[model samples]
Target: MPASRNKKNLQVQRSDHTTIWYTVSGPAEGPTLVLIHGWACNRGDFDAVTDHLPANYRVLAIDLAEHGESRSTRDVWTMEEFARDVAAVLEAESVDTAVVAGHSLGGAVAVEVGRLLPDNVSHVVALDSLTYLSLFPAQSQEQTAAMVHMFREDFAAGVRGLVEGGSPAGFDSALKNSYFEKMVAVRQPAGLRSIEGLVHWDMDAALRETKQPITVFAVRAFATQEAIDRYGDRFDIVLVDLGSHHFPVEAPEGTAKLLASVTTE
Candidate 1:
C-alpha cells in the first residue's frame, strides 16, 4: 500500500470538560502504533514521523490532558493517569493489539500503558527516554524535592536546563532556542505538576511489572555508558546520530525507519 495520506483530527471525552485530542491515519485494520509526545509537547511533534511511517500501519498520535489541544480541569498528573488517557483512546478506537511508543516523558507513560494494558500492548518503545540516569529511575525523597523545587521556583530555568541537557555540542543555537521556547510555554500547573509526577514515579517498579519487550532509541552523543550498563539487560538500547533529543521532529524519516524496524519485529 502507498504511504498513508489521510489524517483525521479526533478526540475522546474523558470527563465533562476533559478530552484528549489526537490524530488518526492509515488503515484501521493495520498493525497499530500509538505515539505519545514528551513533557510540554503536543501530538503535533509526531506529525512528520507519522507521515513517514509505513502505509500499512495505523497511527494514533495523542495530546495528553492539558497538552496541545487536549483540555482538562483535573489536578492529577501521575504517569498512570496519563496512561489512562492513552487507554481511553485505544478503547475508543477498539484497538485489540498495539505497539506503544513515546518520547521523553511519554516514554514513561508508555511503560505505564504496557503495565496498564498488558493484554493489549505487545511492546513498548522509548524514544530518547529511559537513558537519563538522573531522570528515568526512581529518585530519593530529597532528590525529588530538589528537582521539583527547581521547576516550581524558576520554571523557565528548569525548562532551559532540559533543553540544554538534550542538545549535543555545537548544536544549532536557534533550534535549541526554539525548543526551549515551545517547551517553557507549556500550560501552567500541569507543566509543573507533571514534572513532579515524573520525578516521583517509580520506574523500576513499572519495568518490573511490564512484561512486554521494550526497546529504546537514544541519541548516540547524549546517551551515557552508565545508562546502557545499568539498563542493558532490561532494554534493547540502540543509539543513533539523529540530531538532539528531539530526533523524531529533527529526523522524521530516520525516526520512522527506526520505529518501523521495531514494529515490524
Candidate 2:
C-alpha cells in the first residue's frame, strides 16, 4: 500500500473524554478534503488513497470516535453525534471550506456534518454509500427493532452479514475473511450501538437539511437501478467497477481520482 507523504498525526479532544485521531497532509491553504471512513473501519484505510491525491490539496483522514485510536466514553452513537466528531476536527483546524467525503457509514456522517456546518462544507461525497435503500433510509418501528435484535442476538454474525452483503459474487474468500476479522474487532459497545444508530438514521431528513451538492461513487455490481431511480435526482450517482464495497482500499488511485474530480471542480 502506498503511504501518504509528510503525514502528521493529530488528535482533538471533545467533550465527554472523546478523542478524535486524524492525519493531515499537504499545504494548509490548499483546497480541503475531509475523508471519513466507514463503520468498523479507520482513517488508515485511506492511507493509499491520500497518497494518490493531488499533492497541493489539503487532506484530513479521520478516525471517528471509538473506531480507531480515537476513544470515547459517551453514550450517544447517533449519526449526528458522529458528525460532531468531524466538526470538532474542522473547528480545531480552523478549516473554512472543504469537500467532505465519507465511505459507507461515514457517508451518513458526511451528510450530518454538512447539515451541522452549512457554511463550511461545500460538497458531500459518498464512497459506496447512501444508494443502499435497505440501509440508508430510516426504517419503521418494527423494522428497526428486528434489525437491532438481529445484531444484539449475535454480534459477530451481524458483522458477518454486513461483510457478505458488501462482497459481490466471486469475491475473494481470503479477502472477505480479512475484512470480517478487522470489522469484528471493532471496540465493544460502540460497535453494536453504532449499527443501531445507522439503522435508525433519518437520511432523508438530513438530505433535506443539507444544501450541498452530493455525489455517490457506487459499485457497479452492487448498485441497484431502483436505488438510482430513487436517488438520481438528489445525488449524482456514478457507477464504477471497483473491487467491492471496500473499493477505496482495493483501488486507491481510482478512488483518489474520483475524489479529485470533485475537489478540483
Candidate 3:
C-alpha cells in the first residue's frame, strides 16, 4: 500500500457525445467509491482524498465533460446530465454498489445520483457544498438573469471575483491568486452554458426525494453562513475551520478524513 498517484485508467464516453476522463485504483475485492469533482475541476482534484483512502478500497475519480481533459457535450448541460455521466462511469467500471462522494457542483450531482441510482448507490457524501443552489439569495428575475448571463459568458470574471481582492479566504494570497488563474483559464462557451444550466436547475424535487445518508462539510469562513446553514439535519454536517474556498487544494488531507468518515457508518 504505497501512494498511487499516477495510475490513470480510462476515458468514459457517454451517450450525449461527451467523453469523460477517469481513473480507477485500489484493490480488486475492495468496496467501490466514486469521486466527482465540482464545476471546472478535473479528476486529479481528488488526489489527496484518494491518497488518504485505504489500499483495500477501489476508488474512481472522473473529470466532468467540458472540464479537464473531458470533451464538451452537444446538449445543454444540467445537473441531471452531470449525474447521468457519473452513473455511466460507475456502471462502465462494473461497480454494482458504491459510496458516492462529490464536492461543490459535483455534490449537487451526487444528490441527483442518490435519487436516480438509489439501489446501486450505497451512500453519498457532499463536501464543501450546499444542498440547494438557492443558498445564494436573489431579488428578482433581473438579478437572476444577469447572474446567468455572467456565468454563461463571463464566468472567469465571476470566479475571479470570488477569489480576488476582498474574498480572499484564510489562505495565502499567492495560493488564492494561483487558483483564480487556473479556474479562469478553463472557461469556454460550453462551460458557461453548463454553469447557467446548473444555476437554473430546480433541486426541490431531488432534495426532498433524497433519503440517503449525506455528509456535508463547509469552510464557512470561505463560503458564507447561508451556505452552511442550508444543510441542517437534512445532512450530516461537518465544518472544517479553514477559510479556503479551494478546500480540495488547500486542505486535501482534512477533506479526505471527512469523506472517509461518511463511509464508516
Residue lDDT tens for model 3, 1-265? 3375546669877775788788888875688888998777678788777887777778888888788888864666878788888888887888888889887778878888898898888888876676334422222577668878666566778877656532443547788777777777774766676667666666656777887887777665554555546547577766676446567766777776676777666
Q: Positional deviation of 56 in candidate 3, in angstroms?
A: 1.0
Evaluation by lDDT, superior candidate among 2 and 3: 2
Which candidate ranks first by lDDT, i.e. highest?
2
Note the residue pairs that clash in candidate 1.
Answer: none
For every model in order, what is the number of clashing pairs?
Answer: 0, 0, 0
Clashing pairs in 3: none
RMSD of each predicted structure: 1.5, 1.1, 2.8
The residue-by-residue lDDT of candidate 1 on 1-265, one tens digit each, is: 2254699999999978579989999899999999999999999999889988998899999999999999889989999999999999999999999999999999999999999999999999999999998997999989989999999899999999999999999999999999999999899889999999999999999999999999999999978999999999999999999999999989999999999999999
User: Clashes in candidate 1: how many?
Assistant: 0
**Sort by lDDT, best first: what order?**
2, 1, 3
lDDT of 2: 0.95
Kindly indicate the candidate among 1 and 3 with the higher TM-score.
1
TM-score per prediction, in order, is: 0.98, 0.98, 0.88
Error of 3 at 198 (Å): 1.7
